[model samples]
Target: MWDSRTPGIPDELFERTEEVPITKEDVRALVISKLRLREGQSAIDVGCGSGSITVELCLQTRGEVHAIDFDQNAIELTKKNLKKFGVSAHVVQGKAQDVLPELPQVDAVVVGGTWGDAGKVIELAVGRLKKGGRIVIDTILIETMYHALAKVSELQLADIDVTQVTIAKARKVTTGTMMLARNPVLLISATKP
Candidate 1:
């Protein structure tokens, strides 16, 4: 449904559920900016969820796309969205720790979930990231963010940056519009050295 070259696709267009999270539009834009993907640069979405980020990566890079998630329902939902958007990605139903090692080196990676194994997940992703490659990890938990930051630094990644994104959108209310803030995320971006 989204045929634009621009990155921010509205969140409502993607098939979503409470169990499977889709990166909100504003956050997706920031993540895409951090990735700095160019045409034909391959990427992997470590936690595909509703495939929102996966579809964006596919459109942005026009390169090989791989998506991994541990939940089967999430996998199915991802496939549906991929089909809906007429984009293709190799959707793998497995944990990042297990799936990331098998994939070929890529230009960028976006990790959305770690299943409480942020340290190992970041390590594996970095292992497969090509030299000069970019990686972005989104986590709401302070502990997870801290763990990811430490892991990326320990791996000696370059151009490391992290932003605590707090976004709010205006909504119609009685006689006026009100701003409602979405949950904050610690967005981490780095490049393999």
Candidate 2:
């Protein structure tokens, strides 16, 4: 696993618009580390908002990456970002629960943001995952966290773990450097038994 302290994607690499939230580099690094994807191993990125995480995943994995988003703008941004990075992926514009079943079984599934149906998405994703495949979910709300946990239990995934990443960055001030706290995000990860 790459050091979490090392940056994954610079904040400036993406063109953010239309309130599409891009994953910060720190959290992106955490998710990628947990994924542990290898060359020629396929993965899916659900709710790929600004495609920042999707781009990073594309760079890491030589296999096919399916970036799914319900929003049209997010779909376009993901395509643009992939083009900019000179990597290839199957950018799908649709809900995860619908798109995942159509795609081939993958080695990894990442739920970066679920649109209120965390359990259903988890259920669908786990069904499509190969044996011993890894699933990493990023949840910001308490409700989503609990829902995902319940699904993980129902699925009986092994090596289940959760990490809350609360990052603070240093900013230049007139007098000295100051710390600025970013919103905390929970990373709920597990592997198929």
Candidate 3:
């Protein structure tokens, strides 16, 4: 189990699957920071792959976390990671569009995958978010950033922020250490008003 209250629980600690992707630890830190969640706040993790973000949210918020994913494997992986972390969350295996409506208002929403419907996901996420609630959309593809940006702008959310994170981890080479770059992630954050 993770001992610290900080975000970025090492990437290896979580149960993972090759088919499902988990947001990296360094990137998770930024996502959690943008959330600005406090204890007792509720959050919805859309496309909760590997449940890394869900675990962080549960640990940080110490509140309710609804983890929704379209893939059953992702849901199972998320549940396993949650169990490993000794954190509990509402793990649901369904499309975001279908599951989001059933949940009550939430303090934050984080979208890790859109499955090609970034706009639709953002719309639903913003709709269920409470006033002053924060939303973070994490996209590895540039196309998603464009769609999310346009949708968030159309909604006229406040405090819109876009960031591109590039992390390079050091690897031990024969003589020295070399930096291995991971894929870049673009984050779009906004607050509901």
lDDT of 2 by residue, 1-193 (tens): 2322333777787778867888898899889899888877889899999898888887787688888999999888888888887777888888888998898888998997778899999998888799989999997898999999999999999999999999999999999999999989999999998
> How close is every model to the real structure, measured as TM-score?
0.98, 0.94, 0.99
For residues 1-193, could you state the per-residue lDDT of candidate 1 as single tens digits? 7878889899889988888888998999999989998999999999889899999999999999999999998999999999999989999999999999999999999999999999999999999899999999999999999899899999989999989999999999999999999899899999998
For residue 66, what is the lDDT in candidate 1?
97
lDDT of each: 0.93, 0.87, 0.94
Candidate 3 lDDT tens digits, 81-120: 8898888999998889888889989999999988899999
Query: Which candidate leads in lDDT?
Result: 3
Put the candidates in TM-score order, highest first. 3, 1, 2
Q: If the candidates were sorted by their lDDT against the true structure, best first, what order would they fall in?
A: 3, 1, 2
Candidate achieving higher lDDT, 1 or 3: 3
Model 3 per-residue lDDT at 93: 89
Which of the two, 1 or 2, has more TM-score? 1
Query: How displaced is residue 147 in candidate 1, in Å?
Result: 0.3
